[model samples]
Target: MDAIDPVVGFFGLGLVAGMLRSDLKLSSGLYDTLTIYLLIAIGLKGGFELASRDVTALMLPTIVIVAASAVTPMVAYQVLLRLGRLPHPDAASISAHYGSVSVVTFAVGASYLGRQGLDYDGYMSVFLVFLEFPALTGR
Candidate 1:
């Protein structure tokens, strides 16, 4: 409960701001800067974790995750096109979005787990980075 209070509070703050038509907004440059900073920080932490581990220990899991990332978009496209009855272009666009990783979600989940005193490999951040390219390129 304590771990999630800040999240809920911020969400409520945002909701109130929106309802009041608050003029506060993030500039595009600030948004891009924050995004790059987060990516670099995550990558640096992952690199440090990987540096202390045996490479071969991670190879199999890395390969498996990359392969799955590559395949996700195609499966999503098929599901959207066939089951959702969406047109080809719309399905492709939506599937691409579905396939890519959400950095915010990853960060939030990691933070939550840490707050709960659960253990996880920080190296998983490396996998999250790897997931982006294959999902975006479908290869």
Candidate 2:
């Protein structure tokens, strides 16, 4: 109930962006630009974090979590497409984004938390890499 605004915004944005289906539309390009910015920003920030992290303590769990994040979307996409009757490509694309909490959000939240004097656990930084394992590999 508290999380419905963003969901509704997504549906509204999708509909507005869906208006032109003739292979290419103005809104489609805008959508693509927005998506690309999201992907690039997330990747760049994650790369920065990895660069600044201590490798010795981070190596093992980092490897496992990353693997999990990579695999979860495939399983999720399959489940959504098969059991949920979603179109394959569409399901996969959406599942990939949803399977992991966005790194961008985490980065911003961490910064705000820091400003508010909250110290975070070290392991939480690498948590995303391991998220897929539980969602995709667990019961």
Q: Model 2 lDDT vs. the true structure?
A: 0.64
The 0-to-1 C-alpha lDDT of every candidate, in the order given, reads 0.83, 0.64
Please give the distance, in angstroms, between residue 49's alpha carbon in candidate 1 and its true position after superposition. 0.1
| Candidate 2 residue-wise lDDT, 1-139, digit = tens | 3333443455456567678543434587897887677556655655677777787877787777777676777788888899999887789778877676754466556556656679766346546535644455644
Q: Which portions of model 1 show Cα errors greater than 4 Å?
A: 1-24, 136-139
Task: State every prediction's TM-score relative to the real structure.
Answer: 0.80, 0.48
List, residue by residue over 1-139, the lDDT tens digit for candidate 1.
3545554445567679999999877899997997898789889989999899998999999998888787888899999999999999999999888778888778767777777899999999999987886755644
Candidate 1 similarity to native, TM-score: 0.80
Best by lDDT: 1
What are the clashing pairs of model 1?
A: none
